[model samples]
Structure formats: structure tokens, C-alpha cells
Target chain A: MAHALTIHNLKAQIQDKPILNGINLEINSGEIHALMGPNGSGKSTLANVLMGSPEYTVTGGQITLDVQNLLEMQIHERAQAGIFLAFQYPVEIPGVTVGKFLKRALETKISGMNVSDYLKDLRTTMDFLEMDQDFINRYVNDGFSGGEKKRMEILQMLMLKPRFAILDETDSGLDIDALKIVARGVNRARGSGFGALIITHYQRLLDHIRPDFVHIMYNGKIITSGGEELVRQLEEKGYDWIKKEYNLIEEEAHEYSTN
Target chain B: MDDKGIVNTNKKSVLFDYQLNKTPKSSWSADIRKAAFQSYTQLSWPTPTDEQWRRTDITQVDIPGYNPFAIDGAHEIDVPDSVHALSLDNIMMRDTALFQSTAVPLIRKRVETATDIFEVYNLSFFNAGYFIYIPENATIQNEITIRYNFLGTHALASPHTIIIAGKNSSTDITIEHSINNNNVYIHGLTVFLHENAQCRVNIVQNISKASYFFSTGKVSLSSNAVLEYFEAHTGGSIAKTMLDAALDGSGSDAWLRGIYFGTGSQHFDLGTIQHHNANNAHSRSYYKGAASGTARTVYQGLIEVAEHAKKTDAYLTNKNLILGNTARSDSIPSLKIRNNDVRCSHGSTTGKLNKNQLFYLMSRGLSEKESEQILVQAFFEDVFSHVSGGTADKLRKIIREKISDV
Candidate 1:
């Protein structure tokens, strides 16, 4: 199977402090990859870099969506090029209705859909997500609850239907019912020609989505890659073992640098 | 004085006589005319040394030989289509008395009850304006629009409007002033709201580029009465407007919103007062101004909660957006609270547009110029929301058109 996204030797920094250090990963189509890491292990950093967030500087890296260079494009351009990022902390845009914003994004993406048919499609997606129809008319995430924000993100993803998506900690603060709903929504997008990078701290989300590959990220690098067993091991033991192992590797690198 | 100076002064007196002779006179018009001439003589034109006149240069306004024109019926008064666009009914101009018996008696009464300099001046030298009276317990659904257009050289136009909203009556009145010719114009408006009445007044001053405009409005609100006053100042070489309101009874409310946009060598000055004299009265004021080129604007707003007026709540704010290096704006908001239980606050902010907001909008596919226009429209949204009916939409269109030209 061909890969949908490829990140090679990605090294990123924030104000000269390394966050993502020479990380390499490839996500294939029709597959879900789980990126599990402890706190401050550059999990969110990698997601932001892939989404072309300006906060993180790419010191040395190459991120490609199929054959297109992702780094050369603007944020909205990246979004238009079929890269969707479900932010860990979504921004609130006041006075703009959710339906209007979704329609704008969709129009920018597809460029030719009729408004009435687009609205009908949106209503269908809202029904699938069990979202209140009134939410579509309300301001975009303005005064929305945490669960509503997460659900709205999923709703946008469904409306846009991007080829590659980065779900950055989408299950972090959701309730059990909300988590299940979110997992079900993600699984619905998991078939043919769709690829997702699910970045999370816990293995609970993996149980529902059942990723094809699990990767452990530490010190900005993917140290281990395996099947679902890696996620289970990280859930059982936590990231302490990986931290210890990376500390040894860092000591060895420092010794080599001094010599 | 020298012979040249005496000759010049005598010439001005002779000019005044000729102008007065050209005006038509009614039975009680002589008394009012005498009073106005006396008031104009007593109140001197504000000097540049005065704090209120510091920002507004009156050098060009010091024309000594320009005689005040009276309604001689020599010039045909053509009401512009823009005036009709306002769609105001029950309009009573200063001439409204000639046709209506009730309006004449009411004007006489208002002239008798007047005390302020502007009111006395208007009553004394008033030639024409609209006198709108919403009778007791009557509601006028349509807005009453009155237009005062000055169309000649050195035209001293004194137009007066007296609005009486009786108990339980409600109405909206829009007073629009425009000058097609380069001339001088002065006008005054006096409004009275009885117990439980509601009135919304929107005043627009769009004079000629080479004209001077001086306007004053006085309003009195009774128990449970409400007044929403809005003004848009966009023209004139020199313009000074004063709006004073007295909330005299319990449960009375007053809201004042204004916008002044100027360019070139224009000078605009505005003074507003919200006086709370009774308990439970509330007042709010928001005024925004934008200046470009060498245009200057001054906004002075006062909120006074009288003694023993308990539970009075008042707020006043003024914001200015300076678009040019030579453009300047002065905002002075004053609050006087006499009661211990009253709540009062005032704030003023002067700055250019936020670059971050512009960048954010531009990043979302809008051009930089388009982004600026959106931010400007958004900045005026809060002020526009207070405007109701088709007038608000019209004002929005006008603002958008003007911004695009910039």
C-alpha cells in the first residue's frame, strides 16, 4: 500500500530549544497510526508542525503529503491540500455561525458545490454525530462546552472529508460517552483511501479505533514501531521506561559530541 | 476707531437691515427676532484661547459682514430625494405653524418656555424647521425625517425642530442637514418627552466641503420616558454640535451614540451631556470618531448624576481611529456623581486598527485592503447595532461606500 503522509528526519525547535528531533514516520492509506508519548515529549509539537502551525520552527525536516511539499504551503493552503488537524485546543471565532464556517471551508476545498445541497449534506453529518441542529446556527465554538468543541471538530472533519487527518489529543478531556462517540466517528472515517494519525497520551482511544500501527515518540523521535502491542505496553507501564531509555541515549550522544 | 473700521462696522449694520427687510414677518415674529439678535450679540463666538475651541479653529468662521438670511420666500426650497429617503411623517418645519393651528399654539408655548442660549436664539430668529407632535397616547410607527439644505453663499440658515411625544406616545425622528453650496449654516433642535413616552432621534450633519455648521439640540425626559439619540457627522469645513438631555423623572432612560468621520481640512466638535435629576434614571453614551488628512475632531461627553438621584446608572465611552499622520482626535469624558448609591463609569480609547486582527483576516483569503475594510466595519458594528429600522442599513451602506473610497 502507498503512504498518504511521510515525515523524514524532522527536527523542530521552539526558541532554539529542540522539541522534535529528527523524527521519521510514514502513514499508509486505509490505516490508523497511534502516536503515544508522555507529557512534554513533542507529541503535540509534531502534530502542529505537520499542520504548518507557525509557532514551531522546522530547523531541518521534510514533510510531504503524497508528493507535495507541505512546508512550502500556507496553513489554509495545507488545509485545502487535504490536510485536516483536529486541534487539541480549538480557537473560538465569535459572530460566525458554525454552519457558515463549515460551508466556507467546504466551498474553499471543493469550489463548486451548490449551497442547498451542501446544507443538506451538513444536516446529515450533524444527525450522524447526534449534534443539535441549533448548533449549526450558533457562533463557531463561542461559549461551547469541551465536549461540544470536540464534537464540532469531528463534525468539521466529516464535512471536509480530508484525505489525511491529524487528531491531536482529541480524546484528552472528553467524558466516557463523548470518548466513545468520538472513537466511533474516527472509525467511520477509517475505510478506503482515508488515513489518520491519532496522537494521544493514553491507550483508551486505541481500543475503539484499533490502529494498524503504534509508534512510541520520545525526545522528538519515534524510538519504537510495532502493532497494537506497543500501545498496550505503554498503557500498562506508562512512559517511564521510554524516558529512561532516551536518557541513556542522550548521555551517549553528549559523550560523542565532547569527543 | 478709525474711519475704515467705522465704515466697515456701518456696512455690516446696513447689510443686516437689508437682510431683515427681505424677510417676511408674522404677528409674533418681531419679538422672537429681537430676542435672537440680542442672544447672538451676548454670546460671543468662542475664541481659539478657549479650551472647548482650542482644537476647532474659528478663523474662517469670523466673517464679520456676512448677514444672517431670513425666509424671504426668495429662494425656492427644494427638498432633496435623500431627505425623502428618510421617510419621516408628521413633519412640522418652522413654517408648519402657518398651515396647522395646533402647531402654531405649541410653537408659541415652546418659545415662551425656552431659556437656553440655543433655544432663545432659535426662537428669536427661527425662520423654518419641522415641529413634530405625537399626541397623547399616540404612537407614530414611521420615522419623521427633516432635511435642512443650505444652497447659497454665506447662507445663515436657522432651522428649529420641536418634537413633543405625549404620555405613552412613541416615535423616531431623523434630522438631516446638508449643504449643496459653499455657505455657512446654523440650526437648532428642541425636543420634549412627557411621562412614559419614548423617542429616538437620529441627527446627521452632512454639509458642503466649504461650509460652517453650528447645531444644538436640547431634550427633556419625564417619568419612565426613553430617548435614543444617534448622530453621524461626515462633512463641513467647520462643524460644532451640542446635545444636552435632562432625565427629570424616575425610570427615565437615555442612550446616545455618535460617529464622526472627517478628512481634508475639516474641523468637527461635539459636546454631549446626560443629566440625571431623578431616581432610577439610567444613561449610556458611546461615540466613535475617525479622522484622516489634516482633519481634527473633538468629543466632550458629560454624565452628571444629580444629588438625591439614588440608583442612577451612567456610562460614557469614546473611541477614535486616526488614519493619517496629521489627523487628530480629542476625547474628553467627564462624570459627576452626587449620590452615594449611583454607579458611573467613563472610558476613552484612541488608536489605529489592530494589526493582528487585520493579519488574521488577511490570512483567511481576504486581501489586505479587504481585511482593513472588514475590521473597520466590525469596529462600528456595536455602534450600528443600536440603530434600528432601514436607517441602520442605509448608514451601513454609506459607511461602506465611504471606506471603499478611502
Candidate 2:
């Protein structure tokens, strides 16, 4: 009821193929939530659909931030409304530098930061992320390694300073040091009107950023939800137990999974 | 000079009457002009059937009934002391043989090999032209700038320019092409960089939107000659430009960079050729362009390596960005490599802006158009980076304004 971000009956599809059957989730300000799931369980689909990616079609859903209708706004409108999604695969933009991207973003309607102050803050943020100051001059994610791309995503998140953020597998390709650095940024942004839905498969990331609540999603549906215990259960028993315990019949089973 | 220059009321073959009226300074220059005019008469204007002319149709250009020579005050060329404008000497060399003409060193070296119909036309009937002689071992610190202001509609202006950089000499030439009104113009250039010669030529073409333009360039580099050429095509309704650079001497190097932005039904046909004839020669050419509105751009480039030109290095790339549905771009990068012991590669990409890139930028607060402008500027970043600081900044400002206009 008192959530900064809320989603109800979120049904979405890509290329007319329904992926998110009905995703219901909520995140309160200053709280961190973890959505754990197997690969291709509509986790990324929900993230993209929420961020208003043009590739996906939201058939039926209501996504709101502090009572503002999100589904009706444009892709950037959602960002200006304090919603940020750290992409699982950040697009590489040749010729656009990280500094330019951050500068433009900070100067947008939301942040309204000026040039000198923005640059100073950017340098401080860059230093905190353990990124070279020269990295800001390089093209946005162009020629960046997997770990560097993820770190760049986190760097943007720190600068944007959104109210509610959805991080899609930000830990997938990071080393231990990078993982710690990213989690530290998240932890630092935790209490300042910031809430996040951290999407990941393994619980190793949970070791760094302690999730207030844990969710188990299977086949576009969240089958179980609990506090921290769900992560321990899923980690120890694996996903097969959840599938069998819930008796989730194969929804249109195929001979070979395309995904 | 009448605002309407040399208006031939007799529409039936103004070519004959025009040639008869303009007398050559010397029998030698007369012979060259007469031979060129004869060649022009033998070869009529190119039809659409020609391979090179297939994409562009210039038969609609009515060359007759219009002025052949530039109006009275339009072709006033002011040359510095370091530059020897050959108009006077050409008059003095009229009696000399073709090869023995005192201007031999100031004339063409490698004839236009890809002789399209237009190059031949320019060579034959060039009414307004000049030959520039950069004295041997003469180093001119400041670049000489020549800006052509072709005035009058339906006017026929064919200008031929020959820049001869003598042995062991270094110079820079910047030619800016501009037109006062709509006209049909054919321009040609023959540049020879002799042994140990170094030259940098910057060509800026921003002709009027209602005009038709055909331009060709032939540059030959002798052993140890270094040539750097940069061209930017920003204005014109219809334009076709071809530049051919030949590395005839070993240790010679050539670098070519070009940028073009077309919009509002504009048509650009750009082509380039890098010919390697000697061993250890190097050449790199890159061209980038942006098309919006109903504009269409066609780019074709070739890198030719001779059979014995081993150890040659060549690289070519063409990139185009389309801004709207009606905008179209075609890039053709081909190689004619006869030598097995050479390094040559070509690449091209023609497409609209990337959706992912667009989304990525918009997510950070830039409007759709602002994001596109930024990306388009960034698209030409590599090419501009090769240019001088001042020239690059000037181009950046111009491109930014043009992008906003489109």
C-alpha cells in the first residue's frame, strides 16, 4: 500500500508471443527486494516491459510509481519519474562517450544538475566505482569487457540516483571485486528514498546486498515468496524442487526449448 | 558584364559559336584548346546507358543557349607571389609543341583513367580554367584559398584547375566551391605531386540547392611524395564527385577523408579510387555521410593494387546514416587486387540510426531529435578527428547546424 513502485497483473509479450503471464510485484522506498528465477522465466521480459522497451508489448498490466501511471508514459518518462533499469546487456553506442551520456542525463528535467557540479560529482562517483576517470571519455560501453559493461551500468545508476531501480542480472559477468563494488554502490544508495528490485539467478550476490524480501519465479509466474528464507530454500533444494512442489505442468511444452 | 553572361540567342549548337569567339592566347594554348574542343565534339553528352552515368542523368542539362564563360568579374583569381598563375605563360607558350610547352611541368600527369563522359567533357570544353605552378622547393606557409562564385542561371561553367607541386616542394591548397544561383557546372582538377613533394588539399563543396554539379579530380604522386586530401560536401541539389589518387612512386603515401550531409531531396553520387602502382605505397580513405528527408546518397570506392605492387597497404571504409524513411543511402566498397602480396580491405554500412542506441540515449533524458543529432555528430567523429583542430571544429559547427535544419 505504501510502495514507491507497484506492479499488478503485469502481462506482456514480445513479438506477439506472451512472456509475462501475470507479474505482480511491489517495492517500498528505502527497501531492497530480490527476484530470483531460472533462465528464460520471463524475468528479463518483466524488466524490459516495465522500462517501456519498444520490443515488448504489455497486454494487461498496471505499473505505477508513487501513484503516477507508468504504462502510459514514454520510455524516458519512466526514468524521469524516478524509475531506472540497469540493463542485463547494455547496448554499445559508438561515438557517445560515458561522460556525455551522464552529462545529458544529469542535465535532464529530473536531476537539473549544472556542468561544473555535475562533472565534480561524476568524478567522485567514478572514483567510488573504481573506474578510471579516462573511462568517462571512452564510448558508452563500446569495446568494454563484460565486467566493465556491468560496472558502467552501475555507474549510471549511481549518477541517476533513481527512486526505484530494477537491476537485471548486474552480477552475471562480474568478478568478485566488481561484484563487491556494485553491491557497495547499491548499499550506499539504499536509504535515500531509493528502492530496488535486484534480479539474479544465483544467491552469491545476495551475500553482498542483503535482500529484505526474496521471490521465486517459475515460468513467468511467481510460485513462492518469503523473506530471505526463500533464497536459502532455493539455493539448497535447486529449482527442480520448487517446480515439482508447485506441480507446474509444462505450459505448452516443446520438444526443444528455443530459449 | 551583363547579369546574363554570353547568352547565345542561336540555340542551335552554341558550342561551335562559343569556341569560335574565345580565342586562345598562343598557338600552343590554341592547339590544346582546339584538340580538347574537337574531342568534346566527337563525344556527345553521356546518356543513362553508360555504366558510371546509370545512377545520374545529366542529359537534361542544356549546355547550349547559356553562357560558356564565367560572367565578367566572376573568375577574378588573386594568386599570391608563391603561386604562379599560368594564364600569362600559357599565352606565351602557344607556339610550343604539346610536350615542349613551357607549361608541360604545370599540366596533367596521369590522365583521368576512369574517363567518364563528364571528365572528357571538362577537358575538352573548359571555358574558364587556370593552371597553378608551385615552384620547386618553394614552401608556402599559408594555404592559398580559391572560392568560386558561379553566378547566373542556366549558365554553363566548366573550369579546369591544374596544381603542379614541384620536386622537393611543400604547399597547401584549399578550394571552396560555391554558387550564387542555379546553374549547370562541370569542374575538373589535375594535381601532380612530384618526387619529394608534399601537399594538402582541402575541398569544400556547398553549391546552391537548385544547381547541378559534376566534379572530378586526378592526383598523381611520384616517389616519396606525400599527399593528404580532405573533402566535405554539405550543399547541392545534385552532385557527383570522383577523386582518383595514384601512388606511382614507392614510399609515397596518400590519405583521403570525406564527409557529406544530404537532405531535402538532395542527390549525392560520390566515388573514389586508390591506385597502387609501386611497392611499399600506402593509402587510407574513409568517407561518412548522413541523409535525411527524401535525400539519396550513393558512394562507390575502389582500391586497385597492381600485379607487382607488393608490400602495399590500403584501407577503405564508407558509413552512412539515414534519418528518415524516405532517406536512402547505398555504399559500395570494392577492391581490384591483382597482387597476392598486398594488404587491402574495404567495409561499408548503410542504415538508419540504431534503435538500441536511440533507446539508450533517450533513457538518459535527451529528446529523440537531440539524441539523433548527437549520434550523427559522433558518427563523423573519427573522420573529423583526422582533420586539423580549426577545420574540424568548423565542420562540427556546420554539421550541427545542418542536422538541426534537417
Candidate 3:
């Protein structure tokens, strides 16, 4: 069976400096995967590349979503194709209301829904996220708090109803309560037809939104993959064990060459 | 060499002689011709040395040796549907059969409204125009739109328009200036809003690239009257405009907004002044311009609060967006506040697009061109939102086309 999202040997760089080096990953339908790594391990870079951010150039690779070539589509087209990214730092679009922006995005996606029906769906999503009705009238993330911003990201994901989503550090600066609310919103989005790849540096979020698999990234590459236990082990022992293991493998390879 | 010919035979003989030969002495147009001839000779064309014209060069304005076209039955005008969308019961369509049939009487009455020397001169020389009048306590629901189309080379066209809003009444008017072919265009207008009346005016100048166009508007406001004006200029080799409003009554208000976009070798100059004479009056002005290629733009705004005009409030702001290395813009915002206990301020800024904004939009799915268009539209949203009527939709389309061209 085909995967919902697939990245094959993706090599990307920023100003001649390789960031995502031969990275490969795939998420099947209804699967939630957590990608955890140390600082500068290219976790954010992977998410940005998947979203086709112009800031990072893909030197070589292929990213496909449900048999569609993701690399060839525009950012908005990728979004309309049911691929959504809950940015770590949501951008503020002034003079545009949250409700207005959501309606426009939904219209761009569906294109045939009338204003009344769109508003009805939006009100339902807002209620599901436990968001205040007043939030809809405010400018998109203009003066929203960190927690509010995170909730808004989830609100969009819920409203847009994308097939595949990449949540990049959604819990970075959130408090425990805010993190729980964000995880609840994400969990609500997960079902038999949805798939997600959550990028985080800590295992706290994993405690709330349990992942089907956990991937450990080191030096811009995924070195290990395991079940939920992997996150627990990495949280207790940290990435030092993974680094030593890779070092030992390198030493073994060097000795064999010398012999 | 007859006495009649010699009497006009001076260094400026060609000016009046040409006027007299082209117009009959007994005709109403002859009076306008003589007045314009005298004003043309008496008031020399504004020079670059003048303070108001310091930033704009008028040497290439094409002022000499052109006769005004006479309004005749042969001159057929096709009124676009968009122009009629702003029709009001009190406002007559300038090109309708009824207006065409009663053109002589309308012109006579419009000529009689001009008592000022310069206005009288314009009246005497005006050939084709429109007259609009609103009765007391009568409000117009739609905006009145007038379109002037010129279609020949070296042809001089001066279309005069007069608007009168009666006491406690309100209405909106839009005047569109367009040229189908290369030509010389000169136009003037006078508007009067009575006590407690309100009027909104939108002027769009989309002349031909090869044409030289000049327009002037003078407005008088009564007590508690309000005027909102917007001007959009995008074409012409050399376009000069002057808008002056006098707040003659207490509690009157005026708001002026303008936007100009120029490319190639186009030169656009805009001047505006708000004269406050009544107590507790208020005024605000905002003008912005975008110039690309070798184009140049100049904006001058003045807010004058009289000595006895206490409790007055006024503000003026001018901003420019420069797109190319050779494009230039000059902004001058001045305030002459003579009264105490009044609030007044003026500001001006000139800069290019924000790099961060461009990158932000591009990162979200839009190309560089699309990003620029969004930012430009966002910048002008405030001005366009204030515009009410079908004309707003048309103006939006025109701006969109211009953005795509860029």
C-alpha cells in the first residue's frame, strides 16, 4: 500500500551548507510519528522542506503525498492538496480577521461552499478547540498570546481538515496546561483517515499525544526508529547514548578497513 | 491691416485674433473665448521657480497654440455602462438625449455660476461639460459619474463640471478622465456644498501616455458641511492637478485622499490645500504615490487654520513608494496653524517595499509578482474602502490591471 506522505533520500541545503542530508521518512494513513532530535539536528529543516519553504533549497530528493508530486506544487496548492503545516511561530497577517482568513483558506480549498455554510463549519471548529467566539473577529494572530497562537494553529488544521499534517514544535513555549490543550486539539484531528509527523525536542508532548513510532535524528539523518518505548528511553537517557553508539559503529568500520 | 485687426495686432495679437476668428461675437462661446484669452495673457503659466511648482517642471506641459473644440451635433459620445451606474434622480446624465437637447441652457446657467476671474475665464472658454444640482434636504443614493474621452492629436479639450449640494443633503460624484488617442487635455471643476450638506468626490485620471492633462478643482463648504475627496492618477506624459477647498462655515469637515502611480517617463504633480476659517472645523489629508522606471511624482499638501478658528483639528500625511533606481518622488506636507488650542500635524515619508514583507508573502505560496501586488493593494485599502459606489469596483479593476502590468 502507498504511504500518505513519503520523503526519499531528501538532501537540502541553505547557502551551500547541507542541513537535511539524505533524510528519508514515511507516514502511513492513521499513523502519528514523533521526530525527536538534539539542537541543530535538522528537525525544523525537515519540516520546512516538506512544506516547500523557499528559504531552503532541495539539492536532491522527491517528496510525494498520496501519489501526487508534492515538490511540483505551489505552497498554497500543497495546502489545498490536504497538506497542512502548523508552524512553530505562526505568522501574523494584520488587517485580516481569523474568521476571514479561515473562510478564505477554506474557500480556496473547497471553492463551492457559501459564506453561511463556511461560517457554520468555522463556528463548530472553534467550539471544538474551546476557543472564544471573540477570537474569530480579531486579526490573525496579531496580538494573540503564545498559547492562543498554538491553539489557532490547531484551529486552522481542524478547519482546513488536511490529509497529512506536520506540526513543527507546536509545544515549544507552551505551559503544561497550554500543551495539554494543544495536544487535545491535535488528538481530535487524528482518526482513521488522518496522518501526522510531529517534530519536537522533548518527550513531554509525546506523553499526551502518543505516537505509533518515534524516530531519533542525528547529524541531519534518522539513525534509529522504534515504537513508543523509544521516546521513553530517549527522555530518560538523552541523545548521548545515541551519539556513543554511532561513534562505536564508526570505529568498527575504521578497524575493518585497516585489517 | 484694418483698424479692428491692428487693435488686436500686438505681441499677443495671435492669441486674441485667433480666439475672435474662431468664435462668433454674438455667441455665448465668444464670451468664454474672450475671457480665456485675457486670462491666458494676464496670468503667465506657473514656473518652476515658484514655491508650489519648485519640484515640478511645467516647461513640457504643452500650453500654447491650441483651440478649444466646439460642442456640435456631430460630436457623438458613447457612454459606458459603468459611467451610468452612479446616476441619481437629481443628477442628469451628461450624454443622455435630454441633456444633449438642453445643453445650451445648461451651459448658460453653468457659465453664470462662475463669478471669480479665473472661473469666469474657464466658463468663457468651456465647450462641453456637465451640470448637477441637488435640492434642499434631498439626498442622492447613487454616485454621479462623468467620463471625458479625447481622441485626436494636438487637440485641446476643457470639460467643465459643476456640482451643487443643497442644505442638509448628501451625494457622491466620480469624474473619470480618459483619452483614447494622443491629445492635449485641460479640465476644471467647481463644487459647492451648502449648510449641513455632505459630498464625496472621486477623480480618476487615466489619460493617454502621449497626452498632457491639467485639472483644477475648487470647492466651498458651508456650516456643518462635509466633503470627502479621492484622486487616482496613473497616465499622461505630464499630469498636473490642483485641488483647493474652503471651509467657509463653522463645523465643516474635509477629507482628501490621493494615490498616483507612474512609470516610464511620466511626470505627475499634485497640490492640495484645506483652508479653515470657521470655528471647530476639522480636516485631514493623506496622499501616496508609487513611481517606477524613470518616472517622477510630486505631492504638496497644505492645512491652514485661521486665527479665529479655535478648537480646530487637522492633519496631513504624504508617503511615496519608489520601485526603480531612476524613479523619484518628492513629498511636502505643510501646516499653517494660526489659532491657539488647536491640534495640527504633518508628516512625509519616502521608501521602498519592505524586504521582510516580500519574503513573508513569497514564503506563503505567492510569487514575487503576486507578493508585490498584495502589498500594494493592502497599502491602498484604506483609501479604496472610503470610496462608495460602483465606481469603486471599476477603480479596483483598473488598479489590479496596473499591478499585473508591473
Residues B1-406, candidate 3, lDDT per residue (tens digit)?
A: 1223433346344545665565555454555456555555555666788776687777665454444442221122233332222222122222344334333354454445543333444554555566666667877776666776656555566667767778988787788887745566677777878899999988888988888778777888899999999999987988888888888899999999998888888899998988888888889899988887889999988888889888888889998988768989988778888868799889999998765555444433455676676666556655777887466567667666777876
Q: Give the per-residue lDDT of model 1 (tens digit) for B110-132.
A: 55565444455555555566656
lDDT value, candidate 2, whole model: 0.79
Over A1-259, each residue of candidate 1 has an lDDT whose tens digit, in order, gives 3447889999999888888889999887888899987667788889888877677899998999888998998776777777788878776655456776677667776768899999898898888888999998887677999998999889888888878889999999988898988887888887777899999988888888899999987667788899999887777776666657556476544432343
Note the Cα lDDT for every prediction shown: 0.74, 0.79, 0.75
Q: After TM-score superposition, what is the CA distance of residue B44 in candidate 3 from its true location, in Å?
A: 3.9
**What class would a CAPRI assessor give candidate 2's docking?**
medium
Q: By summed lDDT, which 10 consecutive residues of candidate 3 chain B come out lowest? A: B84-93
Candidate 1 TM-score to native: 0.76
TM-score of 3: 0.75
Q: How high is the TM-score of chain A in each model?
A: 0.93, 0.94, 0.93
| Two-way DockQ contest, 1 vs 3, winner | 3
Residues A229-249, model 2: lDDT tens digits: 888888999877787888866
Model 2: residues >4 Å from true position, as ranges? A1-3, A110-113, A250-258, B1-35, B65-104, B108-117, B120-151, B156-161, B166-173, B305-315, B332-345
Strongest candidate by TM-score: 2
TM-score of model number 3, chain B:
0.82
